[model samples]
Target: MDKVFIKDLEIETIIGIFGWEREVKQIVRISLEMSFDISKAGKSDLIEDALDYKKIGKSIVNLVENSSFFLVEKMAEEIAKLVLKNKQIKDILLKVEKPGALRGSKSVGVNIFRKQ
Candidate 1:
């Protein structure tokens, strides 16, 4: 399958198990890779014929920013569902990370893969 990606998407939202985490927004980094057929778009050279990464990114940012989640696992699931709504997508690879969530660790995160 052909591939498309949006990387290092950062959003601020309430996401954690702690009480303070629920009260404030924290930064979450996201990355996604999905199967998309680029043949038509490549041949036609038309934006309309291609999967719109900008639109997808905007929607993801909106979803992450407006919603609260206690786990990156759940957030990744939701994101997978959102992207899968596109019939052209065959499968997805998603990563969600909470940087600085661990005191001494750089980040904590989850990765999920789903197929249609």
Candidate 2:
């Protein structure tokens, strides 16, 4: 299947397991690779025939920015559920990372796969 992807989409929200983390919002980077067949769009060469990636990305960013969660795992699951609402997507590879969450690590987070 063909894929549509967005990388390093950052949004600020309260996310963590600690007391201090719940008090402040931190930036979380998100990456999503959605499996979608682009054949129709490619053939029609029309924006209407294509998957509206910008709209999808904006919705996800808005959702994440407005919500608070203690775990990235839960966040990932929620995002997958929301994205899978689009019937065009067959599966997805989703990654959520909190940069600087670990002292020596570049970033820490989870990667999850969801299928329709």
lDDT of each: 0.95, 0.94
Local distance difference test, candidate 1: 0.95
Question: Of the candidates shown, which would achieve the greatest lDDT relative to the real structure?
Answer: 1
Per-model TM-score, in order, reads 0.97, 0.97
Minimal lDDT window, size 10, model 2? 58-67
Q: Model 1, 86: alpha-carbon shift in Å? A: 0.3
Model 2: per-residue Cα lDDT over 25-56, one tens digit each: 99999999999889999999999888899999
Which pairs of residues have clashing backbones in candidate 1? none
* Steric clashes per prediction: 0, 0
Measured by TM-score, how close is model 1 to the native structure?
Answer: 0.97
